[model samples]
Target: MEIYNNHKRLYIAALLLFLALTLYAALIPAYKAQNDNAPLPNSKPLSEQEALGKAVFVKEGCVACHTQQVRNVEMDKFWGERPSVASDYARNKRPDIWRNTANLMGSERTGPDLTNIGKRQPGKEWHLIHLFQPRSVVAQSIMPAYPWLFEIKERAAAADVTVQVPEEYRKNIKGDIVATEDALNLVAYLQSLKQVSLPDGRPVPKFLYPKQSTPDLKGMGTQTEDAGLDGASLYAANCQACHQQNGEGLPGAFPALKGSSIVTDADPKALITVIMKGYNGRVKEGFAEMPPIGVNNNLKPEEITAIINHERTSWGNNASKVTVDEVKAVLAEIGK
Candidate 1:
């Protein structure tokens, strides 16, 4: 009886030991992953203005609509060049008041992911106008306008940044809409939300997930024929965000491509020059200058010609097609 009792106690001890080992085995990898993926050394620290802007962003509930995380999935290719990794968000710090001062990986994506917004859209002027009234920039955008962040002035001061609201939306306002400091701060914060690249020599970590089966499709064999890249498609991809689909840009914001003398110019050099180097000169008062698209976007000569040809052809304008060699010549002549 004594031997049997001792044997039973030994069995219980062994079972407990086995259970503890199993738990440790399950948790050690997670802890190691957290330790291995430290934030990059050159990760940008937010400025005072940007920190304040982050407070405003939280206060305004912008996180409710926008997600900062770029998940690893085939469908998320549009959000960023690669799926977001742990290190990408390692630098993010939450507000001081929260006990969990670590992550702001939003719960849902009512708006587009902002992980690479700084690189994707670097135009401060565009951000200002969009913040003042999203509908003016994106015709079908469901974003709520934050008009309170702006003030109506009879004429904008030299120091004030004027936001170009469309006439239809500005009918009630008496003067130019100037962005407040808060608005500027918010823009700064938005610009700071860039995803830094992983450190050198570090391979992207693979996330383990359950295997998913391909979905059933009824008409896989009847898919439409492939349409090769065209000038129109090129324009739609690059220029339509500002110039708009109809080529009628928002009045006083982006100049309209439709019937514009620049688009229909006999000498394509000027257009090529603008494409190679961004136009930032104020052609008219109370309007923002155009940023150099070619250098900023790194558009190749062939791509520039395609965009120029598309802009000239679309919107009922008749202009000679620009060749790749012509674009190259202009780019060299202008020293771009």
Candidate 2:
């Protein structure tokens, strides 16, 4: 009994010592990051609505699944920001939740990484729609709906709430009730999850607006055969039937074309290549991307070119067109 007691005492003492060291190490830097950088976000502070949404995030125990800090490795490999430092956590926090505490880690990426998830594709309405009913916009999304966030109103109350969709994006909000202020706040909080740049220990700009320049295509894809076709039209004809006209792409398969920055970026080459040669990525980011649909026996190079130009230019964008020549060049480069 005495021997066992001695062993138990030693084990407890060692465990306590280890915990004390880990906490001291982790908390110091965390505290410093928060205190140092504090509330001086490149963007504005949280609004009343956003604050409320944050509370919802907490009450929902989102922490159990996700982490705010972007660990260095995660930031580099997965494109997440480095781990949340003390300065990052410190600030004009009202509740000071975990002010002096340090406990942040991930159980699994059961849900997509929330780090910098806000403004993921701009257009606040998209977030509201997705939150209200993810499967409506994302065929394979695993995230649960937060319909409680909305009030379910009849008829569009605000111009902002009524998003422009294809005549075919038929699955409208089930109930007429629209989203409420709290729902808006949650959306706002979500939009606030932006990529923060801390250059030389001084944080850089974090904005809801895209930091990079967007293109502006005016008269590009007006080909004789493909003339007058908008992005929606092209998407429906060439891409949508497979990717879904609404951009809800098949799960574990084809990806959504709508709201894809790749489709919107100024670089028409990538857009052209993706459309022409098709793409392949691990199932993790949305499944191994499918083979190029345009390169198949069904579509022609000119049609692919017209479709790419339309998608990029029609989505409230100003991108240059992918000339048939450019599409040709891509095919040649791919040895197709």
Candidate 3:
């Protein structure tokens, strides 16, 4: 009561109280968090180019649309192998002396989470084209283009990494599109954003509220031949992103699958081989080298068969449907 009546005494008491609250509420927990969370052993620090890319990402407001975090939910599984943990971010450091390390694990996911985008879509060419015009690769994509990140050149120099923009999206532009240093760095940062593997024997966290397992729509399951797989669904999940729903791939970047000879061939070996081993021979044709989708996605024989059947039957191509047994034989022969 006396202290309350005395202004100087009351001020001293309030200051002490505030100090105690700050110590208990902030300082202590902050110290504990720093001690408890260590970077995963396999986690690598961002390289110089990747750091520049991150700065570009921040500068360009990429965090406004995209998120880096993968939540612990079954729906988020497609974005990452496992739920993201604190260790996933432990390696993050400040951008430089002038800036603090931004909490880049963004809040709103206006776009797909990039927790493991490096693994999901690793092709540099694809990223470059997508950056130039998202609609070129994904017709339904609503992402805005970053044309400022590229330059139009009358003819690309030998050292230039040219982007293969499709004709329609080119808007009658007269020159080849070359990625600027900022664009390349931004992609490097994106491509570096892979989910590191947990150290040996560490129990991985499970996604919460697991959805009832559906048919292997993405071909990452062990469905039987008679399981009534949806070939169209398979195509949409695993193939449509690059090949397009119409089977007409992005011009100058992805080859058309609509009237592909490989899809209609009597022997499915060529198609299956490409799917399994991946293909780069078409790079000379201005198309990006295809990653081994079948192997990378861990597609089962039945799932591969379904996708093959869909591609063969759809887009006005009536190639005979390949059986699951045939797919199995092909995969086995290729040692996949």
The number of clashing residue pairs in each candidate reads 1, 27, 0
Candidate 3 similarity to native, TM-score:
0.84
How good is model 2 by TM-score? Answer: 0.48
Global lDDT scores for all candidate models = 0.74, 0.56, 0.86
- TM-score of each predicted structure versus truth: 0.68, 0.48, 0.84
**Who is ahead in TM-score, 1 or 2?**
1
lDDT of 2 by residue, 139-233 (tens): 55677877676664456655524322232332564535466676677777777765555656765323233233323334756333333335455
lDDT for model 1 comes to: 0.74
Q: Which stretches of candidate 3 lie over 4 Å from their true place?
A: 6-12, 214-229, 265-286, 294-303, 324-336
Clashes of 1: 1
In model 3, how large is the Cα lDDT of residue 304? 87
Per-candidate Cα RMSD to the true structure, in Å, reads: 8.6, 13.3, 4.0
- Superposed Cα RMSD, model 1: 8.6
Worst 10 residues of 2 by lDDT: 205-214
Best by TM-score: 3
Best first by TM-score, ranked = 3, 1, 2
